[model samples]
Target: MSGAVSWIYLDVGLDTCTQGHDCQHICINNGSSYICKCQGGYVLNADQKTCSRSDACTQGHECQHVCLKNGDSYYCMCHEGYVLNADQNTCSRSNTCAQGHDCQHICVKNGDSHLCTCHDGYVLNGDQKMCSRKNLNLTLTFEMHVVVLIHVLMVMIASICVNSDKSYICMCRVGYVLNPDKKTCSRKKPRSSDTCAQGHDCQHICVSTDDSFVCKCRMGYVLNADQKTCSRKNSDLYKRHDVFATVF
Candidate 1:
């Protein structure tokens, strides 16, 4: 036999092929080469030497019902009590009640809503948005007028009573008596016969109802019943009346 190149035995009980021999459709190991199989969720490259991630979601290319696309994968989520607006990235809640009702109290706006409450000194009306005045029937203006009128009348009566008291005191002054008219006082004067210093005309005289007398007259009169004394009325003229003597 001609000289034959001996085949080398590789490690681990494997017969190694000689260089430049073709092995069809089977894996061959070189000094540092090894074969690997693609796992789940991964795909082998066309040469079958490497693996890459298999994006299953992107393959379908469609998301249903609250699912969103992120890169090559899909994520599922729902809006927070709201919905995406025409621009899918933005969200919006309803604001139909934002301005609230047209009433007395203030309207408070909350997220997506509003409510109504009464202001001070008022109560909520049937509509819940309006407020009506408290004590609606009470009339403060009229009550004030009535109180003022009463006070004025009381002041007027007090003034009249005060003036009447002063006038009554003045009427009781000395040498005066209450007139039967009750509005005046008059001096009590004696009759002509009882006048004092009855020579000249008496200027004034006061006689008590008890038959006593006080008199004022011009000079030259003697006290007598008539205001004119006997010496003044008739020089040496004497007249006599019942138990009384007078100069005539």
Candidate 2:
């Protein structure tokens, strides 16, 4: 008899918020338990006990780079080498190098754009950002000559040679992209099936690239410290005017 009584008390228990909860704003009734919910303009955090600001990046916030909240309002911030537009919302690229633009050697401005150049005796890498010592070895020279010949040949074949590293890379022209072979510039279709290797298991989205793949977060979520994981944005940034529950 006690075993049956104990099962009802422990297994199918019911202390579900009948005596109030630690939820900052409100508590919701579940099937056999309860959950905490934040008020409007707020959201519950991963802790499941505290509440933080929500709608931080909504309608009013049109920040170009990042959005920040202060008190009951929100503001915008610009990245380095950028200036806030007159509207105080958007950002525009600035010519000043400052802490922006990853350049290993020197930076030069041409019109509104900038270029990265290496010092003498150094050559720009494939990324056009870092620099390395120029390799003028005979073998490398022969490769360059071979690259030129291949480029000319590609032009005759309705293709283009954009890379000279090791051998070449077929730079597909507009309305065209490289086929699975990475050599044939096939006409671009409306959409292509995701061919990412099985077991990619990205949280939200996975984008395939020439070299590898990129993982991206979904809307209303931000990439966490671990690039593969995601978390609700503004969930921990609320302070002023936001009454949060303390886990005492």
Candidate 3:
């Protein structure tokens, strides 16, 4: 009988707050009794009726990254290589390559910057982010001889060579420059950029010149019309001196 009375006293304390009472906050029915409660960041006044702002963060928050606390105030922060989410509590991986980049082919991270590259059948465009199909025109392998002649004729119109003291000095017209052979001419190359100056796009070998660059193919292969690509050299065709016909 005494134990039952003790249990009743423990379950219901004072038991004064009710629906009709002026709590100025929430009313909680704690078993048979009631208590006045305030929302988050609020504290109940000494009168047990009024509530005031506590200017504080609730204890034991679930911040995904790190929880920052300053006296009674608190916030959340993310670690490196992560970003804070919209809820200001959770975090996400730093999506610089997928969400923040404009690369149309491949995006690779290099130190603090990102590098964009294209696939095998594609070449990087002027923007360096987008890719374009390589200009390997549809033609039979035997027909490259004719294509070579066309490329030579295009070079002929650009510059001319003059004989001086048994040697030759190429006199290039505007926007043209002497080729690696120093006898023919090719179009003036693009301005060497800091990005491109660091490397070349050749598949086999990259050769640097005075004012430009050149791509070379290894043995058993020949440089293609695109000057960067390569194709197998026809040894039988090279043996036939009549294979090449000079273009006028």
Candidate 4:
């Protein structure tokens, strides 16, 4: 029996070992040979049939903050108050107010931007970059003597201050022209040919004057409530039509 060939072995004709035998991850079959492969986040063990944990934070990893090992790969993640940068390999401050904030009073940090806020007794202006006085109503809550004293003090502080029914008017700078409303500067002298060039909203004609312009309508039309637009007169429109009435 020692020199004799063993005929007790039977061939099943199926290559199960070469197909997927003992592969913990993937099995690659090459004819009568086979190779085992591990999925992402796993490495082929020394036995070549099982898989082991792959260190995601090892060399060749490019995570910004934390490198999390998933089922078959790894992902980059950021920590609190930080976000992955554009390159995805570094972290930067997520607050938007970290950069150049132009807020006049307060700069509230947001997720990726900032908000402007005014302090007490101040309100944000139309431009939102500056603050203005909060109590613009001009109603006097103090005694008459106090009001008079305040007005006197304000006038004393400003040499060119002038009070009017509507509002206070300030003196214009040299070579600058005051507007018709008498509150703000309109333009400079050596004016252009057209005085209404900037804010003339006339629907028909704008007549230039010494310092400003007057809005005028055509011959057949009259000025509307806006004083800059023209409308057909009711008298002229009704004159062309005959009126009739019926009593029920």
For candidate 3, the TM-score is 0.28
**lDDT of model number 1:** 0.49
lDDT of 4 by residue, 1-248 (tens): 56977676534565655544779988876455677899876889899989988866663578868887664567788887787888867898787666568888888986666788888657788887788765434533344235346447655332244444433445655655566654344436586777877678789999988878888998868998887999876774555553422221
The 10-residue segment with the lowest total lDDT in model 3? 138-147
| Superior candidate under TM-score, 1 versus 4 | 4
What global local distance difference test value does model 4 have? 0.69
User: How many clashing pairs does model 4 include?
Assistant: 1
**C-alpha positional error of residue 5 in candidate 3 after TM-score superposition, expressed in Å:** 45
lDDT of candidate 2 at residue 105, scale 0 to 100: 98
Ranking by lDDT: 2, 3, 4, 1
State in Å the error of residue 235, model 3: 54
| Alpha-carbon shift of residue 241 in model 2 (angstroms) | 99
TM-score: which is higher, 1 or 2? 2
lDDT of 3 by residue, 37-137 (tens): 88777789998878987744455776887887755677889988777999989998766685477899789876445789988767788988999865444
Instruction: List the candidate 1 regions with Cα displacement exceeding 4 Å.
Output: 1-83, 93-108, 111-113, 117-122, 125-135, 138-248
Per-candidate TM equals: 0.22, 0.30, 0.28, 0.32
Provide backbone clash counts, one per model: 6, 0, 0, 1
Clashing pairs in 2: none
Candidate 4 runs further than 4 Å off: 1-41, 44-49, 52-55, 58-60, 70-72, 97-115, 119-133, 137-167, 170-248
List the pairs of residues colliding in candidate 4.
40-72
Q: Local distance difference test, per candidate?
A: 0.49, 0.70, 0.70, 0.69
**Per-residue alpha-carbon lDDT of model 2 for 1-248, expressed as tens digits?**
55544343444556677757788888887767789988877878898978988756664677889888865568898987678989989998877565367889998875556789999768899998899977544334554466557558666344555545444565666877767766556666654355456446568887776545667889868877666777777854554325544532
